[model samples]
Target chain A: MSESAKRQSALGRMMLDEAFEARVRSEPARVAEELSLPLSFVLELAAISAERVRAFRASQRHKDAVRGGKPPTKLRW
Target chain B: MPRASVGIGLRDAYVEPLRDLRDRRALDVLEVMIDDAQFDRRRMDAWRSLGQRWPLVAHGVALGPGDAIGLDREYVRAVSADLAAVGARWYSDHLCFLRVAGERGPIDLGHFAPLALDDGDLAVLRDNAAALREQYAGTFLLENPADILGFAGQGDAHGRESGRRYTAALRACAAGALLDVTNLALQARNDGFSAGVFLDELDWDRVVEVHLAGGRRSGGLWIDSHDHPVDEEAWALLEHVARRADNLRAVIIERDDRLPTLEVLLDEVAHARRLLP
Candidate 1:
């Protein structure tokens, strides 16, 4: 991601975008049904995927801060 | 006898140092972080074997207030069983929510306030409290969390202001406060708020315990991940709070990430001990 583009990643501060959260909620079932993956595997994947996203945002924000950049503003609910 | 002045926040990482602290009389008390799997009879027996017979308060990371769904009954059951196993007096968890819907986070891994604070928030807690009451025979306490990005929706007062409101609400409920000074500083730095302001609003009368830790500022905002030395600001804050709260029970220094020597933590404990009332 571009550095400035990366700066928009708020520091683990994503409000449960009601819509986005709903999307994440349904992802495991969809992966299970479409990819023929085990439900447990899909659930684990979903969790790991979500954690990676949080970690990624966290890293991106950390980089921005280290380079003397202002962090992203808190997202309004 | 009255409680001691300063204490340390406990975690799995510090089990050895905790033993050392008890052995050397370094800490006044230690706040054991409540993990369901960590506290069993065998473990408690082993703890006793190691002479960890000092005063302790159990704190938790799984109190899922603010969830639309009710609390995770299994987790609550574990907490009760754990407290009974350890004979802990007061118990605490973050002032924010953990899981949501039913999926269990995005497993925020005990990150605080991903969800907004509302009446629903307190309701979920009250439900958990009722469940806790049914399972265990002790009172509950709460620790303020550091979420730089405050929940900016309905009734969204976080940081020290939120902590003040929390202090007010928990006071009304006749509960105890587990103030994490490091978190207060992390919140101040990240949220563009004032730690002093938060403390000024705090009802010291309700504070029963305090937690101190060093946070990593890697993520623009600070992480409450207990590592590094107790920063100067947090230590100063802890001393100020310790002096003001007459009912303050124990102060706990927390270390989670950067594994320092026991000597380093012992020194930090000494810093805390010097300020003890």
Candidate 2:
């Protein structure tokens, strides 16, 4: 992948990362300060990430509930 | 094609408010989020109903027009069909890529990724625009994405030197520029340039639409969140560019999250019209 493409991928990954989501959710003010953005903005980012996380988790739950415990092939994130 | 002098981004959250404003004609045009309601029959009916009162403009987020993959064939066709159904004559999306081929097949980036402002990227954009023009038979504009981090090749840390790059990209695409004033404000705030200085450098004639949205500061960056009212800095920048963007046909107020009431948004739209008028 090209350098720009890598950077783009990294950003998307960061958004989908559960750990990163937790950090943002737990310490929005610190994240805001570290990124030089307002707390509200940080909260918004957390909210978006949280929504995505919920959707992913819900999909996971749905898969686990069916399919005889076989791992699903396609992750929807 | 006819254009709206002032408009607002249509959101499901504002459905009732929009219904209230339907007869009043408070908005001259409505920018439909094509991706959200693409194949839903009920929503399509709603859009058709809205179309009766106001002209619609298609705004998408997942077309990935600037990516190496170019315009997704199915996505473009869906958008074009819907636009035609609604009698819209213009289509737009951010000049950024959101999906890429991954080892697992294709990965969807829920966020918009900034394209490098260079000859290669410009050529890709041009090709995508040409494809869109041929397929949709309508004016297509590319909106600049809010940059949280500066691109690799764009000069300086703040992407301050991107004025020519933006102009060049639009020229290459032969597409109208949908100038997102607040996105530029976020760019300036994060990258160390005055939004006014950046706006002054744009070739305003290329601008076909002006987007007014608000952002908030988080971490150490200003995000183009579109959740709050238009900020003072963005309004000032709009005032500077609104006079020179002679081709400007639409001024859209975009608020996606933490949405104010429809009346409040209509008031903002009124304020935008006053500024542009």
Q: Which model scores highest in DockQ? A: 2
Place model 2 in a CAPRI quality band: incorrect
Per-residue CA lDDT of model 2 for A1-77, tens digit only, reads 54434434434444445675677779988866765555764665555434334533443333233222234433344
DockQ of every candidate structure: 0.05, 0.06
Q: Supply candidate 1's per-residue lDDT for B108.
A: 37
- Estimate TM-scores for all models: 0.71, 0.77
Tell how far residue A29 is off in model 2, in angstroms. Answer: 35
The ten-residue window of minimal lDDT in model 1 chain B covers: B101-110
Please provide, for model 2 over B1-277, each residue's C-alpha lDDT reduced to its tens digit, 9 standing for 90 to 100: 3433788898776666677664556778888877666535566778788777788887877777777655678778877888788777588888777676455656765556666666667777778787887768888888888766454323243354677677787788887889998888777766676665566567777888889988776655566767789988778777777777778788889977676888898889888767764
Off by over 4 Å in 2: A1-77, B1-4, B22-25, B152-160
* Local accuracy of candidate 1 as per-residue lDDT tens digits, B1-277: 3645455655445666666554556655666656633434455554343334567677766665433355666777776777777778778776765443212223332345443334544555566556656776676777777654443311224444565567655753356788888887876776566677778777777788788877776534467666578889987897788778898877777765566776677688788878777
The global Cα lDDT (0 to 1) of model 2 is: 0.69
Considering summed lDDT, which 10 consecutive residues are worst modelled in model 2 chain B?
B151-160
- How high is the lDDT of residue A74 in model 1? 36
Assign candidate 1 its CAPRI class: incorrect
